[model samples]
Target: MTCSPDDFRAAMRRFPSGVAIVAAGSAPHRAGMTATAICSLSADPPQVLACLNRLSSTCRAVEDARFFSINLLATSQLALARIFAGLEGGVSADQKFTAGVWRLGVTGAPILEDAVLTFECALVTAHPASTHNIVIGEVRHITGEVAEDALIYRSGVFGRWTGLAVTQPHLS
Candidate 1:
């Protein structure tokens, strides 16, 4: 038997994931949405994958622009995240930029000036997967250093990764 949607969501909630805002386009026409479905797809070619809902305006912008930036949020950016997520009702597409400092990336996508990390990428391909588009992008630019105070989402709650134990295991 297949798991129900609610069951699937419940299971996925147990997996903690980093929070980020995926943005595209230039000023006056930019689009952005809070996302947790971004990850590095490859290192050699420097690629990343971000899943966007097929119906989101940002998804269309990314498709039309063929470029986007993934801005990883810090714990301090919870309000920004909520704004992009449309949780701050009545905030229009253009108004969301007013909430954060933004700059144009090499790919022309809007980058968060104070993001924990930002990845500017050129669209490689987008595959339609059920209700979302699996967007693949080739890294064109990167900014920010790795920091411990990154934002995370799990179990329907937004939180931060507390520095537990930093360790590197040797592979023999």
Candidate 2:
């Protein structure tokens, strides 16, 4: 039995994930894309993994620059996420940076100043996997404070994650 692409996507959408913008390159030659397929790969060496579409300009930029920044979004950054995702009308690739306050990281990758968290990384490796590349990086710098609310995506909708209260169960 084989699962269809649409079915696989639908199934995956059931799992909510944090939103992020993976950006590379410098101004006037930069590229970025909204992504949810980023996660911590290791802690001891401080590494992260981000999946980029093989055909995306961002992926090519990462390949050429050998550096990238993962800007984890806060709830207030929904507009920025939409812009990077190409969901905002009249905003072209060259104009995306205008929507957010950005700065150059140590690696020269563009970082969102107001992101919930920003990880500037040096590209370690990128492995081709089907339609995407599994890009790994060693974190070189980090910034931003812990936000009270974070942007999340689920079922094709953008949302926020607030602190959830957990109650301890009573035991005899």
For model 1, the superposed segments whose C-alpha errors exceed 4 Å read: 146-148, 165-172
Candidate 2: C-alpha lDDT: 0.92
TM-score of each: 0.94, 0.93
2-107 in candidate 2: lDDT tens per residue? 9999999999999999999999988798899999999999998999999999999999999999999999999888989999999988876657888888889888
Among these predictions, the greatest lDDT belongs to: 1
Overall lDDT per candidate, in order of appearance: 0.93, 0.92
Estimate, for each residue in 44-154, the C-alpha lDDT of model 1 and write its tens digit. Answer: 999999999999999999999999999999999999999999999999777899998998887789999999999999999999999999999999999987564899999
Off by over 4 Å in 2: 169-172
Candidate 2 least-lDDT 10 residues: 161-170
